[model samples]
Every structure is written in structure tokens, then in C-alpha cells.
Target: MPSHRPRRLVAALVACSAALLLAACAPTVALNPAADANDPRCADVIVHLPDTVADKTKRETNAQATGAWGDPAVVLLRCGVAPIGPTAKPCITVNGIDWVLENDPASPSLRYITFGRIPATEVVIAHGKNGVTDAAVLPALADAIGAIPQQKQQKCLDTSDVTSPTGTPTAAPPATSTPTPTPTPTN
Candidate 1:
């Protein structure tokens, strides 16, 4: 028994170590991004545009979207005209995902579009130098990017409407109806 004591102690230590390792690698439950606004993993979404689109337009759109959504943030990374034509514009890749933008140079006045997902597909349209967007082509750009519905994408927008009010109102008294005198007494 004396000789086997050390062997038993070593086996016990090995068993404890194996248990601890398995516990550390246990599967974790998934959490929703919207419900878990404080989740560090869920950050703001960013969209990178081609070189042809002007800087002003990119800033305006990024600001607008960020103002609308309260939780997830939206940012514009780049804005410029596509070096090549609309169809041949180099695709911007993010997180191993590729985004295709139309860069039709024949209609240089058309807005340059970029697509991305902050958990939802976002289509960014940039006005050309002339400030005129190709109505027909612009809508298709959104379609090509497969933009999500406004309501669906709103979950990712940072809306500042939430705030704490300073003043508190007094409680109103409950209303009571007065009863009319009975006419039976006159009879």
C-alpha cells in the first residue's frame, strides 16, 4: 500500500487537470446582438466607398444613419469614384466577404454605391460631382446590394432619442362623476 500511494496521488492530479480543461472548453449559449447591446463583440458597422464619391456625401450619410439607430454604430470608411467602369470596379472585401459596386463611367454623374452588413445589408449612395443621382441606376444599386428593410436595419443604427428627463410631473387626481338628484321625490 505504501508503494502505491504516490501512484494514486499522481492519478488523482491527472484526473483533476482533465476535468478542468474540459470545463474551460465547454460550449457557450449564443446571445442576440440587439438584446445584448452591451456585448463587446457587437460593435458598429462600417461601409467603405469607392474613390469617385465625394467626401461630403459620405459624411452626411454616415451621420444620418448613426443618428437613427440607437445601439449599433454606422461609419463610412471611404468615398471616391471607381477607377474602372461601374461593372468593373474593384470589389471591396471585408471579413472575407466581397461587396460589388457599380462604377459606370459613361454616366459619371451617377452616385457611387457601396454595400455592407453590420448584421444587415447596408447600401450607401454617393452623389456625383454634379450632385445628380441616376434615379434608375441608383435604385438598382440598392437592389444589387440587397439592402435590408429600413425597420430591419434600424436595429444597428445609433439613435440618440433615448434620454433621461430632468423634471417630474405631479400626479393628477382621479375624476369622479356627480350623481343627478332623483326626480321621484317630486312625484
Candidate 2:
């Protein structure tokens, strides 16, 4: 009985060791600190994070400033970035927050950095063979990022109607349409 007990204990120890090793191998994300790392707003955003994004589950991140989704990390998010100013780049408002997307096709995957948030966010989508696009993931994070109160002057460009010399709102001329001519008499 004593000999059998030692064998059982040894087996249990080996099993525990294997489990720990596997746990250690689980995915971990490496993230760079953003310019707004110490901003109070970041804390509010981090706690509201959903368990998943873009249908991919959120994985453990190495730092408070980073978030990662998917096994190979198809979608990565980092909050509290330096605010971006107006540029020639295209800007689109998503879920009420304006976003400036910068695409670098030269890289293996497309990386989209958020434009207008005071504490901007960075979303990286791996252009793997799977062909995953940022559109698949960006929406999931929009509202959460929008919750961080934007400093309009610093974080966003006013997208209001362009002013005219008289300071009146620019209105397009009424659209006109010509009635189609009747061909029934010819037929």
C-alpha cells in the first residue's frame, strides 16, 4: 500500500506540472503604452470592456494599456493615445465619435488608428490568409471608446456645415426633375 501511494502522488504531481505549463503557454499580448496612459478616462473605458470583440474572445493582455482578441491576435486595441489633429487623411464618424483611419498597405496587415478621440485608440488587424478586415472589428469597440468624453478642440475636428461669406449654412439648390415624355400616342 505504501509503494502504491508514492506512485499515485508522483502521477498527481506530473499532471499538475503539465497543467501549469499549458496555462503558461496561453496567449499573451504585447502592447506599447499610449501617450494618454495616465489619463483618468482610460480607467473608465477599460472596465467597460466586453468579454468579446468582433466575434473573437478577449485574451489576457500583458499591460493595462492594451487589449487583444483572437488566438493569433487578429484584433489589438490600445487606449490613451496622443490625440490626432486635422490632416488630409479621411475622417469618418462612427457611433458618434469621429475616426481617422490610416492605412498602410505596405505592411502585411492593415492597421487602422482611431483619429478623433482625445485619448485615441489603435486597432490592428492582421492581414493574414484569413483576410480579416478592420471593419469586422472596429464597430465592436466604437461605443466603448466614445464613452470617453471627447475634448472636441483637442480630439476632434468640427464636422458642422461649412460656413459661407454671410455665415449662413450652405444649402444645396432644390433638386429638379423633368417629367418623362409620354410615348403612348406613338405606340
Candidate 3:
């Protein structure tokens, strides 16, 4: 038989080339490591990240404790960030996880910082004509983020908790599925 060894070598080389091509097709996203990116709690969150978010496949990210999804990276998640303090921004609970919305003036992205979870997790989601909404993104991440234990003292309280001078309770705000923002570019 003619040089069967040479044929085997050629087949191996072809398979390697195909793998390299596929790897090159998916670019690794660049991101900055959070303040406590090495926190053990963050590892818990990373391990639970879903393979897909809002119908987009997860992509590789360069930074530790960070994740990106979508071919163009419409959703970016960073864990082990500085925990957020009390803020006047809107706080919403999804799947038992509380997230404080970071309102960016005139920006097309909805940034959410975990409210009571230590070694905080932050998720920046592109929302607009070209991107998915918070309704789709937050719920998808709830299980992954729920890994970080919430501090009992810092729970999110709604208007229902407020009382007037006569001790009469105020009506709770109508529950919204997600925070609504005007459509704009994420850049």
C-alpha cells in the first residue's frame, strides 16, 4: 500500500485547520476585570452562567469573572464589582434577585448593578431597535447571579413599605415586567 502514514498525517492536519478556522470565527471579547474579580463568590456566579442569554450564545471574554453574549456582544456581565450603596434609582426583583438600575442619561444601554449581593455583579444590556430588552436579559441571569448571597440588611423595599403621617400605607407601584427606556444606541 502506498504511504498510508502520509495519508493519516494529512487528515490530522486538515482537522486541525478546520478547528482553527472555527475558533477564529468567534472573537474573544475584551473587558476590564472588576475590583474583586478574583473573589471566590464570583467563581460561583461564573460557573452558573447560561450557555445562552436572550437567544444569543455565550462568547469568550478576556477578563476574569466576566461574560459576553451575542455575536456583537449585546449583553456583558461583570461580577466581583464594588457593591452598590443605597441609591435613589429604581430597584426591581427578578427571580428573587434584586438589581438596582443604573440610569444613564440618554444612553441606549440598561446597566444593572446587583443591589444586596456582595462582590456585586453588574450586567450591561443593549436595549433598542437592535438589541434585546431587560425583560429578556435579567431573568436569564437570575439563576447565575443568585449564587451570590444577598445581605439581609439591604433588601429592596417598595413604596408599599412607606406609610403616611397617619400610618396609612401608600399604594404599591404597578408591577412592571421590566424597566422601560427610550430606544437609543448602546454606544
Clash-forming residue pairs, model 3: none
Candidate 2 residue runs with Cα over 4 Å from true position: 1-21, 105-107, 153-187
Best by lDDT: 3
Q: Could you tell me which 10 consecutive residues in candidate 1 have the lowest summed lDDT?
A: 66-75
Better of 2 and 3 by TM-score: 3
What would you estimate as the lDDT of candidate 2? 0.72
In angstroms, the error of model 1 at 15 is: 77
Error of 1 at 12 (Å): 81
**What are the per-residue Cα lDDT tens digits for candidate 3 across 8-46?**
999999999999999888889999999999999999999
User: Which stretches of candidate 3 lie above 4 Å from their native place?
Assistant: 1-16, 104-106, 164-187
Model 1 TM: 0.20
Model 2 residue pairs with clashes: 100-115
Error of 3 at 36 (Å): 1.0
Highest TM-score scorer: 3
Number of clashing pairs, model 1? 16
